[model samples]
Target chain A: LEKEIAAKDQRAHEQQKFYPDLSGEIAGAVSKRSEPNLDRDFDTLDEPVWVTVKRDLNTVGAKFGLVLFPTQGNQSLLRNWDLWGPLFICVFISLLLHSSEGKMGPHFTEVFTLTFFGACIVTLNIKLLGGTISFFQSLCVLGYCLLPPGAAAVLCKVLTFASEQSSLLFVIRLLVTSVGFVWATYASMAFLAGAQPPRRKALAIYPIFLFYFVISWMIISHSH
Target chain B: MTDLEFQSFHNQVVTNVQPIRDDDGGTTYEFQHSGDIDRVKLLDSENGTNSTPQGNKNLWSFEYYQQFFDVDTDQVMGRLLNSMVPRLKTNFIAQHIHPIPDLYGPFWICVTLIFTTGICGNLAKYIETAGSTINGHFESDFHLVTGAASAIFSYVTLVPFGLYSLLWYRKSEVQYTYLEILSAYGYSLTVFVPVSILWVIQLESVRWALIVVAVCMSGFVLAFSFWPAVRGDKKLIAFGTIVGILGLHAILAIGFKEFFFDAALQSNKFGADNADFSSGALDKALTDPAPNAALTLNDSQSKNAKGAEPKAASNKADDKESSKATANGAPVATADGGGQKDAAKV
Candidate 1:
């Protein structure tokens, strides 16, 4: 009976160790500094919702850091639709760059429609292929994967201005963009590899290849 | 006895062969299992904890700005000085070690230099053009203050935002936060200060050379600072980022050349109007020997010179006739008096 009690205590201690006292200890220390009656305030104080939200955002930020560095932790952030933050940011950026030429409304609409349709097509392909990944996960991977092409688009705008005076610049722009295109293709392939069944992997890659090809074509054609 | 012995020997042989096959299969299975285990371990190591504790300090918060500014201005100055040299320490301080409060200091400093030098360069050109003109007067359609302000504003807002957007797209592979990228870009502008000042030099080749060097230096610093963080198969992305950065800087430099220190403006001093004025003066000097002869020439003489030869001759004839009429008026009056006297005598 005593041995069982000891084992129970040990189990409780182990569980407690795993979850460090996140709130209480920090709050206790802070409250101790400012107020003498720490216990009463500590009991009454409720963490703000914004604080939790901010913390989650920070976690996302950290995940972004991991993505940049590319660690195992990046995989968790990879499969969630919430990770499409960078994609939206890129879209906004492209809009800003495109606005320079005036008549940005059409361009903005086109980009949005294309990206949406592209995501839908990819999602549909994944669904039809008997892949294990969810629709949102596919969308998430596709969205983040579009970043390189989006960036290439922005660079192409700069290149358009540059290419006018120098043919060398045009060639440089082409090379740089092609590099981005290849990278995007490779990155998407690596990232989306899990979403497709083993037998149909090549089939799943076709859409990604098509998507990037269209983007590269647009960038290259416009640059000329 | 013979049948039993034969069956026992066959069973022994079968057992021996089965053990060999089993051993081979077991080794292969174990090898694959170990590989899988290693892969899992690698993934686990890579995936370490994703949740990083976020501080309550918001980038847009006043407290954050306050803290950023609260630091010694000298520290920023030191950073500006250090930014001139592209190295690990400067990068570490800018990116990792110190939390630069805001990009305000570096940004403003760059803006100030850009505007100051831009205005100065424009003014210098204006003064030079004025000095070269016949009337010593030059009017610029480009307003100095307005032009400088607009250019600075565009540089501050557009270029940084463009870069920020690029970084945002690469956020997964770029470890730098928006603030860090902005700060790095802002610090990178320090090279431009000297470049801007050098722009005032009249030598085109020297100016171009200096600009190229400055741009390279600035690009190198920025690329070096961000290079270490880029890893894995994303080296191509990193190269693209660096190239994009250099391209943006080059565009700005080109813009500075085109608008601010415009060679066209310099060349325009010898425009058609100036050519006409100079040629008119030359014609006057060649036609009239005296220095002020062109000024002394009356309107009629100059007009006659410009008019037809027959018109001038006609004008001279009309002048002689008017003089002759005055001269004959006295005789005509006497003749009339004599005729009136004769009539009285009769």
Candidate 2:
């Protein structure tokens, strides 16, 4: 009778163990039966589909207009039809007009080329003054006027200087070196401006000045 | 030159001897002098014909040698002249320096800044003529030359700013107050911006296109120029520039809200009586020009400001936007309604 009682007690303890009452056989269908989680999907997207979304879209459009368009990286259906597409077209036109401004003149390309020549003529006068102007210097000024402004300007300038047919490579190099030194000197000044360059040690330049030029050229050429 | 040396020299003469005097009495004797000074002190060679073999050193300093021989003096003078003047026809000719392609990089940048600034500085004077202005063809050419050189000066001044930004070498241990410097630099930019914009806008036909392009490009360029401040957290920079641009647009909008947003805002309403948008209509269109007007109601509001003053007598005080812009960075601007503005930027 005592042994019977002990067995019944052990059975009772086993019954109390943490286990779901699954009398049915295990199956893959059980795993697939759960409800789809909507919480995460709701969190990541434009939240209030009413006013917030409309306002967001409008403001986003405005902001996009102000920005330089993530000129690359994202693909679009109207890759050649949108603002950037026309931008590409304009840039192409600018490049042609710019490259031949000297060979051609203001009346040909008109506005852009004329502005260019006017600027160039002035640059030459400056050179005559013996401020150590060079071919690259001329090209940089021309490039500045010709290029469609912003990052494109700097990219073209770097590429022109890096060319074997570089006009003022020595002067450019000196300028670049001066820039580097100036950066160092004014790194102090720049620091408060929140320009604490990471790894600002000497190693930073192997990447910042040199590597960036190479990378930028690669990216820009590939883009072209 | 000594008597003894002179005697031995004749004994061993190394020249094709000629008579001391020719037909009328001029002779040229070519001789290669060959002897140590010690030997000369012991002998005399110039007087080989009649001098005794005297070892007197003073014999070398005889006055007759100066009178008899023809020493060349023009060689040194010719060399001096050659050294002073450059060989203008050769590669030694003046260096030909042309400006770079665009207003980019330090090389041409230093050159261009001066160029743009001068033209801008003089543009008011130029356009005011409403006619061709000049000195002479060459003088005009020289003027053009000088006019262009001014851009270089601006360029020179401007590029150092760029180069200074890129330099790696820094000085001293004192921490740089970059924010202060940036604010100062901001002032410099303000000085340049209006000038550039005014110069571009003054040209006809291109004004609208320039306006659109300016709206499009200036904000982007400003951000690009100030990118260093963005560091890794670009969102802040993006936000600030966007806000700054919006604020600028807002300022422009408050003055001419209707004209800026839609073409119909300023469309002509034709009639037999010809009732269309006029200057009064322009002021009426500005719903929020009161604050702007009140701001201009200052001690010395310029002549241009009075043209755009709102009708509401106390309108200026209520709207603080335009007044605020004047109080902030740039010079006081009047309502620019399709006319040439005398503003600038660099």
Candidate 3:
């Protein structure tokens, strides 16, 4: 009877120790469930490929939206750098800039080299100026910010295809391209301007200005 | 490979105080120590930022190309300023860019010139036609960017390549690597950037004067810089190279004037009038050098009538119309008049 009583007591002690451990595990799991970063890592093998692609596409679209409507409150683009948006924007712009019938525009390779290399050089310039941004982050911001000019290029291409070449059309193109140039420069500066040293802001901004200026020039001049 | 070969030849001719053939292998031991020290110093001086030994690296490595771009802003600015002063005695390759030829000045200078030429060319066109009756609506012609790129790139690349080959073929007294010559040629084009911007003033006299000044400044730099490279060659060869260099320089300036700035303006003004005229007659009319009555007619008619076959196809009707338009005024054909003579011929 004493042995029986002692065994019960020992079992009670083990159960008490396990109770605290179980409670701690429950608390840990609750905290992990509430963590915001849980969705960032997903098992690709557990889900369908389409799900992965769809989620990736959603992320890219959200990035594009951020670039399009850049506000001071949202700057997640530089924090999580991705090349998908940049690649798409670059290829689309290059494809649009390629020479079409009767109009002599920049070749595809020319546009590609200009965009990729131009971004690389500009990023290098920023780094040389002691910018706080990472190389890819600056690149992502620059590439994504090209959306405005890309939109302008699209509008110009449509205008060229829709109507005859006239001074009025040209004026419209100039206005559209100027807007795109200004918006692109401003947006990129908004994202990347802080990365540069305060005193050398102008130096960093100048290259960005020239970079977009060249692209804007291509847009305004090429479609006609 | 060519760099290695040229380096060997260059070392044999210029840096070798002792003419010992390695086949004998007797003085090779003596050459090794000095050569190593010289190489270390050269590598150090080439890029103080990254003093990686470049001698053993393959050409395909990124580090090989980095050496060519190892210039600071101050160095580039100094090199750019030095390129503008066209003195006969300044050996650009020897003094400015010696063993280490930087590509930063050449690359950026060429790019700057390309944009300047493209933008300024359009500006000149706009200024020329600003006062016309064509509504003066400004449209940026993007073709100029492509055209300027081709012209300037071909000129910079091909000219240096040709000169390098010529020098290599002749086995010239001073061995100049292709990059050194390319660097010299590229920097010499820096004077054109501002000159191109100044071309927006639509005055022929001013244009000509600008071209002369630019060509002289840039041409003298090229001629004087290259003279030493070819000096040890035959007299005819050396003078011929200099003359060729100057001629090409002048041609490029004139080409910029004629092709980009002048030709388009004339074509826009006289395109309709010259539609039906014979090719020779059109040429004659273009060269008439007269401030004729077609100015007022073109102003009114070409406003919306560009490529209007109904108007251009009927030459007789156009002539009567031109005569009526000219009789109304003192013929304010004060500038760039070409269509009236062509219309009269048709």
**Pairs with backbone N, CA or C atoms under 3 Å apart (clashes), candidate 3:** A221-B142
lDDT of 3 at B240: 57
Worst 10 residues of 2 chain A by lDDT: A187-196
lDDT (CA) for every model shown? Answer: 0.52, 0.30, 0.68
Q: Report, for all candidates in order, the number of backbone clashes.
A: 6, 72, 1
Write out the backbone clash pairs for model 1. Answer: A68-B172, A68-B173, A72-B46, A72-B47, A73-B47, B68-B101
Q: On a 0 to 100 scale, what is the lDDT of residue B244 in model 1? A: 45
Off by over 4 Å in 3: A1-41, A46-54, A65-79, A91-100, A103-139, A151-179, A186-208, A222-224, B1-54, B134-140, B269-346
TM-score of each: 0.36, 0.19, 0.60
Residue-level lDDT of model 1, residues B1-346, one tens digit each, is 9879655443433323333434555544544544565577668866554322234466665444434333333455666776667554346334432565455445455545654564456555755665566544333322333445555555455444554555555555545565566666667677777677677767678776876677666666765665554433264555544444454455455446544665335346545443233223222222222122122222332342343233323433344334433333332233224322322232
How far does residue B326 in candidate 1 sit from its true spot (Å)? 76
lDDT of 3 by residue, A96-205 (tens): 88875443356788788889889999897677556788899999999999999999999999998899877788799999999999999888988998786566676567
In terms of lDDT, the best-performing candidate is 3
Q: List native contact recovery per candidate, as a fraction of 1.
A: 0.00, 0.00, 0.14
Q: What lDDT does model 3 reach?
A: 0.68
Q: Pick out the ten consecutive residues of candidate 1 chain A with the lowest summed lDDT.
A: A97-106
TM-score of 3: 0.60
Per-candidate DockQ vs. reference: 0.02, 0.00, 0.08
Candidate maximizing TM-score: 3
Encode model 3's per-residue lDDT on B56-152: one tens digit a residue.
Answer: 5557875566567665556777788888887657888788888778776777677778888887887777776666747544554555676677778
